[model samples]
Target: MCRWLAYMGEPLRASTIVLDAKHSIVAQSLDSPLGAETVNGDGFGFGWYPSDATPTTEPAVFHSIEPAWNNQNLREITRAVESPLFFTHVRAASGPPIQQTNCHPFRYENWMFMHNGAIASWPELRRDLTVAIDPSLYPQVLGTTDSEVLFHLALTLGLRDDPIKAIGQAIRTVETVGHAHNVQFPWQGTVAVSDGATMWAFRYSTSGRTRSLFHSTDVPTLREMYPTVERLATFSDNAKVVVSEPLNDLPGVFVEVPESTAVTLDGDGYRHQPFLAA
Candidate 1:
């Protein structure tokens, strides 16, 4: 499994959350209490849309096979860049080998995606799923991991037009194919995605028991809840974050995303809906 986070709202240096938070993403790379694996040091990646980028502009990415905590380049770049929307991921390889291409937060055009779960018996289903991808989108499937394949599958299913439905359809296809192969509980994990503006997060699995995921309470609410916590002062009222784990110990600062749900974050704040429904 892996630990990842998505942020949207006021522009802030990526390191503010990836490196400087009390229990930042980089810290989770070495010690994650909620991730399936305690240490997600297999590799890491960062993707963000520059402050100047339009809603459809492509995001820039920085990926490395190095552990997030040990990568000076990540620190340097994160500290130097600021964005209103960005994704950071720390990988704990389930099966795929650690490499740049295999890292999470895979990109396509203006969208970026990352996952913290796996396809049960991926090797058995890869061919059937891969062959289903639209030929036009298949070329962008650069890595062998099920995560990347899932992204391309979503694209083939119309991610650009309707992200939430496309992702649900992608998962549905995976489960349908898995059932044919007699693999039960074929999907497990949380996923986060964005298209330079709005951000979406999903928590689901073939079984009801999915991975842990949470979204930050609105900044004003958090500030009132933790008035003395100086860090609360750094965020704006509209700021929202979705993470695989709570970044800090503040009791009400983070709200757990319900199982089998999708969360959308934008100027309208966070909205939740049932995901992968019939």
Candidate 2:
């Protein structure tokens, strides 16, 4: 398993959440009480869309096989770069070897994606799933992890047209392939995707028990709830964040996403809906 954090609305230095928050994503890389593994030191990644992004513009990504807390560059980059939309992940390798290419927040064109779970018996199902990817998009699958392949699969089905539906389709595809191999719980994880303007996060699995995920309460609401908290001043009313776990212990600051739900974040506040129907 892994831990991930994503933000949309109000540009601010990513370090405010990734490095400086109470239980920052980088800090979680060292001691994550919520992650399946206590430590997620296998690797880390950062992906962000610039403030001045056009529809055709793609986000920039930085990947390293270094532990998030120990990487000097990770510290510097997060401190310097402020993005309206971005994702950061710290990995806890389930089976794949630790390498830069295998890092999360894999990118293709204008979209950025990352996942915090695994495909059961990926080695057995990889072949079937890989071949299902669109030939035009197949060449972009650059990592061995099931995540990158999953992203491409979504793109193949219809992510560009309808992200929420495409992701459900991709997960169903994985389950179908896994059922063929007799993998009981074919897929599992929390996934986040963004195409510069909107961010989508999904919490689902074949078995119904998916990874933990939470989204922050709107900043204005938080400010009213904790008026004395100075940190609350840094954010705008529209700021919304989705994370694998709460960034802090503050009550009402974060809400758990219901199981099998998809959350969409844009100019609209977080909208939650059932993703894969039973």
Q: Can you give the TM-score per candidate against the true fold?
A: 0.98, 0.99
lDDT, candidate 1, 1-278, per-residue tens: 99999999889888889899889999999999887899999999999899999867999999999999999999999999988989999999999898899998999999999999999999999999999999988988888899999999999999999999999999999999999999998999899988888888999998999989999999988777778888877887898889988888878888999889999888999899998754
Error of 2 at 22 (Å): 0.8
Write down the lDDT of every candidate, Cα atoms only.
Answer: 0.91, 0.94
**Candidate 1: worst-modelled 10 consecutive residues by lDDT:** 269-278
Best by lDDT: 2
Per-residue alpha-carbon lDDT of candidate 2 for residues 1-278, written as tens digits (9 for 90 to 100): 99999999888899999999999999899999988999999999999989888988989999999899999999999999999999999999999899999998999999999999999999999999999999999989878999999999999999999999999999999999999999999999999999889899999988999989999998888888999999999888899999999999999999999999999998979899998958
Could you give me the TM-score of model 2 versus the true structure?
0.99
In model 2, where do residues sit more than 4 Å from their true spots?
Answer: none
Model 1 clash pairs are: none
